[model samples]
Target chain A: MKTIEEINQKIKDGNAVVVTAAEMTRIVRETGAKEAAKEVDVVTTGTFGAMCSSGAFLNFGHSDPPIKMAHTYINGVEAYSGLAAVDAYLGATQPHRDPKIGIKYGGAHLLEDLVRGKEVELVAEAYGTDCYPLQNIHTHFKLEDLNQAIMINPRNSYQNYAAATNSSEETLYTYLGTLLPKMGNVTYSSAGELSPLLNDPYFKTMGLGTRIFLCGAQGYILGEGTQHNTEVERENGVPVGSAGTLMLKGDLKKMDPEYLRGATMPEYGPTLYVGAGVPIPILNEEIAQHTGISDQDIGCRIMDYGVPRRSRPAILETNYHQLRSGSVEIDGTKIQTSPMSSYRKALQVAEELKNWIEKGEFFLTRPVELIPSHGQTVKPLQIKRPSILVKDLKTKAIITATAQDNLSDVARLMVDNNINHLPVIDKEGKLMGIVTSWDIAQAVAKEVQELTHIMTKKVIVAMEDEPVEVIARRIDKYEISGVPIVDRDNLVKGMITAEDLSRLVCSRDDKRGESL
Target chain B: MKAWLNFSPEIVNKAVISNLMKNFDVSFNIMNANITPKGGKMLIEISGEEAQEGINYLENQGVHLTPVKRVVKKDNDKCVDCGACLSLCPVEAITIDEEWKVELDDQKCIGCGFCTSSCPTKAIKLAD
Candidate 1:
């Protein structure tokens, strides 16, 4: 077995392409084109590339490449290809290092720097189509190694996209690396612990800095407006290896690098490196029918080698340089200054652009709508009546009452069912008013003080058919703690409150505790 | 050497005397001060001591010395549980509960209203 250094030497020798899955596909296609023209020297890098190349040859009415791609199965489950095989090979070759090890994450470019510096060897690139697979690969490899590891901006892909407006390459590099100078070695159990760590007073007191790695990926997956595939089996089967990587990285970053390196390996494993695949271009005819980009531009960009040589080189060089050494300034203060910085400044600039768009600086472009799950449009929560529904979990009896209910009656209901508020419903089962202890107190005070004379007759009531926002707005407008849901016939249905809104807004899972 | 002794009615007196050899701005003398075998208060007149300092010194020494009387002040009545003054408190004397209730950690609380303005409730105030 060749050592990692040998592999790196082989790559530098131009014996290996070191292409990702996507690039491999393109290579395969090019090879197929060459083969059709009776050229046999062309070879594809990986399996996908070989397949694409073969397909391209068929399209070109030529023979396919002669080479067959190698494949392997990992842990008797996942199909390992390309760099995955290399990762496995390297992992198996290395002597299992001490389980307890400390890891320090620098910028995304840190590993690249290491590789460039010959401190570490790049044996292979794991093939992955998305960040999820890449993260999974990382975890798998880490688990196999059981050594102290550092994840440097594993979420940089998405972070790059999200912060493209405000982030510049330099700003990103500096932001990521500079955080280390300010942070003390800390350890956490899970990714969930990272947010609190960032908010810790010690960070403020000491002017410490922190950056999220895989943990940010977990946050993205768990954040709102996430689109998931409708295929239940696929959705459920998708491994949360990324989440685990995040948790592991969080735990590692919190610890002192040395101590963390020496700490026991987590029972769960390491992640393998997964290479992101390149996107295939749609056929020109198809593109002309669907996309707004001109066919000439697309053809020139993809097919015309001559055109690219003239115009593309400059753009590519500039982009490469920017990717290598861009900087971002905020409020006249230079925040980031590093080479290989993720496009953090781009993200910031995007944000500024979004703000300008909102201010109608020009006709704003709308983001493409995501395909809905199962082709179903999600319906907004609608209020049917003005009443809060409080039900007894055991008895399943709906406790109905109004905001005007007697204090004694309300108290009795609360004591009996062990509930806080009751939904007041009218005779037609329509929502009317919500009665709580506070409401009772206000009503009683008004009665005693004869303040009814000055009270407004307009009782801003919410209809059951209205949206939940109606009730929310009412609560905000009136400064009332709760709102009564009433039906068209003036009958109360249920009551909702600020607490309910908070719970609804903050709930991690959509399913409420109906059983409870 | 013989110790020189002088008598005066005033317990603390300041004298400015110029000598041909040296001149001094002021000098304090303690005369007719109480001296008991059980250790009566020995008034060592300090020319630089402020009036409040003398009173405080006498109080610390367990001497029943009284200075000019002043009006008594009222204690702060409103102490809402807002821990705005906590950070400013040199002693780390205040804490806020999960319910947003403020409480003074007596061991840490120095009774300085460092948190007073921060308190939305205006709960911290100086007392007489």
Candidate 2:
């Protein structure tokens, strides 16, 4: 058995053979694991995806006599300044709830700007003390100004991720990327076959203290990522869901901006696209076998993002082989599933990592503390309905007409409320039909007798529990003035008009504004 | 050989492109165009020996000529390749490859920047 010292010597002497996890797969397939392991000294694996739970800690040098910064804003984005006098943690998804810069820039962009050697406006407010009486400071900081800038991410790489599709009529803006309306398309974001955790399926190479390539810089594994759930169904010894994540730490100063990007998904907020690559030393034939796993063996379920729940329902179980083929079948409909993570970039990361190990610039580290192989699950962010629902948006004190009511009376009611449409209902408040001013005017011109004769019989209704956007699309698609909000039994609850939606726009802006 | 021109509604009925080809003895290849009722823009490659004269003739016909530069820029970070901008491209500048990722041909894209608004993620934008 060759020791790590022997591997180091071989690498130093330019004798060590390094292959990418992707290449090792083919090598192991062509020439059995025993031969592959003996020939290949290391296999590099990489992944690039949105890791929301990532952030960096910066220790800005003592500003003359610095006061303890209680709050901080880096380029108008709030950072966790609760650490010390000058140290702060800028979250990857911070100021996520708001504080938008030019429509969509946030903490991720601020971090990336810093990495690109751009000047960042730093503002801080602190309670005055005798030792350090300065309560506020407005300054500009470059990367060089920071004493130590460390990227200590709680989660970096996901083993696998769910592919997403929309079954609903409207488009879904999700972290999974935008899902097209009515199963128009599906989008998946995991690196899949090129992913780091996929190469080390059972955490054989990925564990605490494992040396890695973090955004083109040397980094190390810290611990289990926030929701590192290893307990998942295995198809060919590879977990089929988001499992076995890692907590990583690296010096942000040494990182490259090309591999580290900031992404903005509407409604979902800002996220960092962390490029991570891990080099796994081939200790045995088993290590080579694990790295050799194929794309067909790596499976991820295509989930429906249309469902309004924490755990979205999976529509189809698929593998990278089929997913990369560019389409998947959901409900017998041929839906095109596209990847969010750039495989072109992921491959480049792996190649660069392979070169690092070959040149003895990077080495492997045995785990100081390994993450549990099982017993973890993601506690989804409770989808709190702080915004208005369709029921809440309705004019509860609704005016209505019956089928027997004359067209003149219904038209008069519309003029009285300055409304365009009147909901026609039964005695039990169940919606029958809707009569607009146009319908009444046409009835008068045609000399029609009753409201049922001229009134539109086909009632297009909005559910009480549905979101406002869903109903808004209905109004736009049909060019209708308003829609009657109803319960499951066709019971007319209230009416939602374009005027109601306009009011929501003002209210949404109020809620989105940052607290002074 | 390359000319970028803008067409306002008043001058759109002038048939300046056809007039230039007939009068100046130049053939033109339309690389991109966003012709509509309100206003329009086009990027065309003028050919034949009299290409420069055709460009001058078209400009004299009240067509505003602009310089050829990057009119559309894609923020690769935000683009999910959902293909929302595919059908919106009047010049057929945006295409989905075998892997279903959206590829934008800047050469064929007119300065109209249709994909900017059509992009669900707002990944594509008109260069300032």
Candidate 3:
């Protein structure tokens, strides 16, 4: 078997045989792991997903009178100024403190903007100290001007995660995405077979200080992530759920902003989309075999986020193969699924890492400390949704069509609103009819019929205080897509549809055992 | 030709679309509209022999027109099938297929530029 040193030598000599986790799987399957292990020098793995515990430490060169900045805020996000002068750590999920700023543009944006070489406003406050006398300072610093900007993320590289679905009657706005009402859809966030941690589930050669591909540059594992747990169950070498994690650190100057970005989820706060890559040296047949695991072999539970809990009951157990297929069966019902992690980016990371290794621009390092097998009674975080009557859900400005309006115009209104339901009202704004997507489709197909002919005259409308569940049931039972919310006078005030119901669910859908 | 129609509050009650259909040989499809008492915007596509005349008539009839030369485009290579860009779509232009993979309908999109920012991978872009 080839050792890491041998592999490095091969890499240095441009004779190394490196393959992605995807390719490694195929090789091992063609020839047993034992046979493939002797031929393969490195198995590269990668993951690009939201990593909240991620942050970067920046050392802005000391200003005129070096302020031992007791407090620091970059773009209104509190940075860890507790360290030495001008040195601070900005956490990924740190909220934006500026009054006009949004959660979408916070600490992660600060990191990204720094990497992009944009000017960032820096604010600091320091109580007059003996050595440092400056009390307050405000200035702009760019990445090129900074002495050292390093990314020191404490936790990342979740081995596996759960599939997230919404089961509640109301729509949920969550990190998993908009979970449609009544088990409408499922969304999972995992790099799957291409994921670094999933490929080397047991962290064999991936330990402390293991050289890795971070963002666009080479990085290393600093230590076991803060929540690193090895007590979890494993099938072969892969963790069933979330298990081991890596404490990663990298140079911000060397990272790529394309692989590292900041995002703002509608209801959720700011988060960093991290692109991480790990290389597993083919030290032995076991390590090679571990990298050979395919998506079909990786197991993840489809957990319902409808229940507001850390660990919700699983709807079904599924593999990445089924997940990658884009749909999975739950209770015999087909549900659409989407990944939160960008497989395209993950694959790019793996390919980039492979190229670097081949070009001898990067090398692998043996782990100083490997993670233990994991354990956790972890649960997928449920996004809390207060089930209220239709009245509580504020409807946007009601856009209606006239009874005499042409069928094409009715369809046009629906298209503009990106809604299927269109309330046909009188000149005084009294609801006379409602047009559903089916009605619009019929209108489009037939090339005939006015709004009066296509609209459902016997409208299924809801009262303001009507429970959302009732509307949902009616929409389902009647097979109608939506119901217009009306007043006691029967004047249309707002409308709700199947699409509206789908936007009501909520959850974190974060990595680690909670969601795979 | 495609143009965004801005109708003022006073013109909201007019049957301009019907008038255009009856007067011109052009056939039109509404991509999106948000007509209200306060005024509204409409993204529409018109095609036929009288397309230019129809656009001129709409403009002369108090309907301001801004020809849309480009729309939002999505890159298949950069897309990860993540649903992050799904909820931000106003026109339901972005939809999840049976497999939960996100599929974008370029025609339905109003090019509002919301999905571009929401996209974590920066796969969606506005292009001519």
Best by DockQ: 3
TM-score of model 3 (first chain only): 0.72
| lDDT against true structure, model 1 | 0.27
CA lDDT, candidate 3, residue A419:
80
Q: Each candidate's chain A: what TM-score?
A: 0.23, 0.81, 0.72
iRMSD, all candidates? 22.3, 4.9, 4.7
lDDT of 3 at A302: 84
Best candidate per lDDT, number? 3
- For model 3, residues B1-128, the per-residue Cα lDDT tens digits are 77789999989999999999999999899876889988898888999999999998998889989887756777875565556665445556777676445787866777777677656556788764
Q: For candidate 1, what's the TM-score of chain A, rounded to 2 decimals?
A: 0.23
CA-RMSD of model 2: 6.9
- Minimum summed lDDT over a 10-residue window in model 2 chain A is located at A94-103
Q: What lDDT would candidate 2 get against the real structure?
A: 0.79
Q: Kindly list the per-residue Cα lDDT of model 1 for residues A159-233, writing each as its tens digit.
A: 011011112111111111111121111011111100111111011111112111121111111111222222222
User: Where does model 2 exceed 4 Å of error?
Assistant: A1-6, A95-103, A329-335, A380-407, A412-461, A464-483, A486-516, B1-103, B106-128
lDDT tens string, model 3, A370-475?
7654453345445364456789876777888888887767677778878877888998889999888787888779876777887788887888876677678778
Sorting all predicted structures by DockQ, with the top scorer first, yields 3, 2, 1
